[model samples]
Target: MSLTQRSSGLVQRKTATVQSVGADGGVEERDDEGYTPDEEEDHDSKETRLTLMEEILLLGLKDREGYTSFWNDCISSGLRGCILIELALRGRLELEKAGMRRRSLLNRKVLLKSSNPTGDVLLDETLKHIKETEPPETVQSWIEYLSGETWNPHKQKYQLRNVRERLAKNLVEKGLCTSEKQNFLLFDMATRPLTDGGIKQKLFEKVQESVLSRWTNNPQKMDKRMLSLIYLAHASDVLENAFAPLSYDDYEVAMKRVQELLGLEFDAESLKEGANELMWAVIAAFSK
Candidate 1:
């Protein structure tokens, strides 16, 4: 089947059932369509256009709560890693040859060859940061610096400020999430909830299928973008969120498959390739 047909089927299957208390204190069943007309239109526009950063943020976000899970502390850094990978894929950044001594990523350096605007605000800012730093730093150091993991707490400044909020706003712009204010009796909190369940469901299925079936035996055959998602999601500890509905045995198998991928090491020849370098760099960041 075509992707559109498959997505439509998934959306139809995911239509939510609403239950309400009737006047007689009994429950009444109400069938509600999952998305509004505008939302449906938006979904068609955004169905296949999500960026790696956007996908990661979506996976990390809680559906109704409109925020990320507490256990996903690594997401900030993971997203930064995603930025690096994206840039590398676009030929904006590369590892310095002289620094690749096979010792450690800490000793290696990431050089910015082109500052040509990526038209992405976050990516452009990250590129500018890399270009402006006096002495170049290694991929590992840059990941931690962008993640806000640093000494001299007062001077550290690479946290990708307002990362969650910015990404949430971006999702809102894409019509995947709705910005709503909720009252907690004392103050109001602004939250972004998944208003387009179809899109999110599709993403979840993609990740689950890749990890559980498609790439389990041969991860090298997975799409580069999907591979990046798996590594980043696992690094952020949000892979469980994607597999939450699976049976115990399925989940266990998926975890084992992921461990297998994580355990695989890249040889020197593979690391010389641009794509492999970025992939290994991300893996190395999370491995630590």
Candidate 2:
């Protein structure tokens, strides 16, 4: 399928449910269960505005704090993985076909045959890096390398850079977030707080419904974008944010479902034939 075809279908499904708020501060529900009218409207308005990377970055970000949680250490690499998947979905990248050289799965390279610009600066820069690197690395290695997961002999630890700040600035440019500078005793710190609460709430609901309801019952029928979101969120270690509001029983069930999904293995033939090959590839990259 064409990129437009694949993306348009998912975008439509995300925003199809229209909603309205009733008096007494109660939200009216439309055809879709578990979504209020305002939430549905929010989803409709912003679902297609942000790229997958932006959405993942938004999820990792802390509201009003202007930065992602320090505890979610894997988010930088996870966001890079999101960029790769988004580029693959857009037909700008593809996995190099297996050859007779007996290479390790983790060493498999990503081929950048298309120079098509995604128009997003971060994504374009990443694409250029992939294209220009010599003796290209596998998806897993690329994720680590791009996230600056490099060994520091001086500190004797792995070091990462400020990917969150860069992406946050991009979000600010898109008007999804506003930047503010605050003094921290000795220095001024910049922060990007979300300006749209409705979209974030809708994104949370989508993940919640997928885990507690959709994936738990019908994994095969789940939307690829939703699947991508679940895997990326978990890989980034920020999935708990999505599950924080659930009841005890619901949380237990959601965790169990996530485990089951993670345990699944896609057959080689199936992976080659499906539109979600990039999704499966991402799962493999994180699983390793």
Candidate 3:
């Protein structure tokens, strides 16, 4: 039989019921509906939902000291499930299932929001980019490992083995990678040879100069312009403090170091203006 049919048969078998009656007069055989009369009666009597009072009582049960066995019993009896579903429907619950267990909800708030289709599209594109642009060496190695000879009854006769098989399998099974994988990728990228402290310094300088041009071109409100200057000045102060303490006489030397890292070609007046701009921008960004 096909997998679908097999799955359906398993479901039917699992959900199936049989009934029998003892001499004392209990149910013996299930009716045509697959459930014994008693089973149906029990199902009908089962509480599938929670009442408002029960919800209030459950909330009360959660104390600073922690819940008791009685409260746990009530939760295990299925009241919590109904209450959780109700909260979810009411946009008051943030559902995060971690391996079938729930996390704490300390200082939590629930707000209703629609899923962002744009974000989903962007995320898919980003993932594709990562896959495409990942070091060619890594991809080639993974492919070679996959196509290597291996045994498999269900898949190709010639199978390679490597981490991608497990990774792809996990992606298909779990839907997506966890946050840990993202962090790992970031660390890996950071360790690549192309990026260094000097590169970061140059990039920051480029971004800062670009922003300065925008600040100069756009005539913003007085308050906005001042705020922007203050922010940049604060950032400069932070950078200065982080560097080795230098004498007031060494200010020129420190400024030269900054220019070197930024890859700036300095004339006389322009060099002075850029230094002032960098210092103010840093101070504005970092200082309170």
Best by lDDT: 1
C-alpha lDDT of all candidate models, in order: 0.67, 0.65, 0.25
| Residue range with the least summed lDDT across 10 consecutive positions in model 2 | 1-10
Candidate 3 residue spans exceeding 4 A from truth: 1-195, 207-288
lDDT of 2 at 167: 79
Give the distance in Å from residue 251's predicted Cα in candidate 1 to where it truly belongs. 2.0
lDDT of 2 at 238: 74
- Answer with 2 or 3, whichever has the higher TM-score: 2
Cα lDDT tens digits, model 3, 146-178, are 343224443232132232223223222322212
TM-score of each: 0.77, 0.74, 0.15
Q: What lDDT is reached at residue 150 by model 3? A: 25
Candidate 2 lDDT tens digits, 1-288: 000001121122343454667566776554332223322222344344566677777777788887777666687778888888777755578777656774444556788868877666777877888787777767776776676664634321222346577778877876668989877799898999989666677677777777765554644566656677777778877777777777889888778787777777643522443444545666678866
Q: So what's the TM-score on candidate 2? A: 0.74
What is the TM-score ranking, best to worst? 1, 2, 3
**Model 1: colliding residue pairs:** none
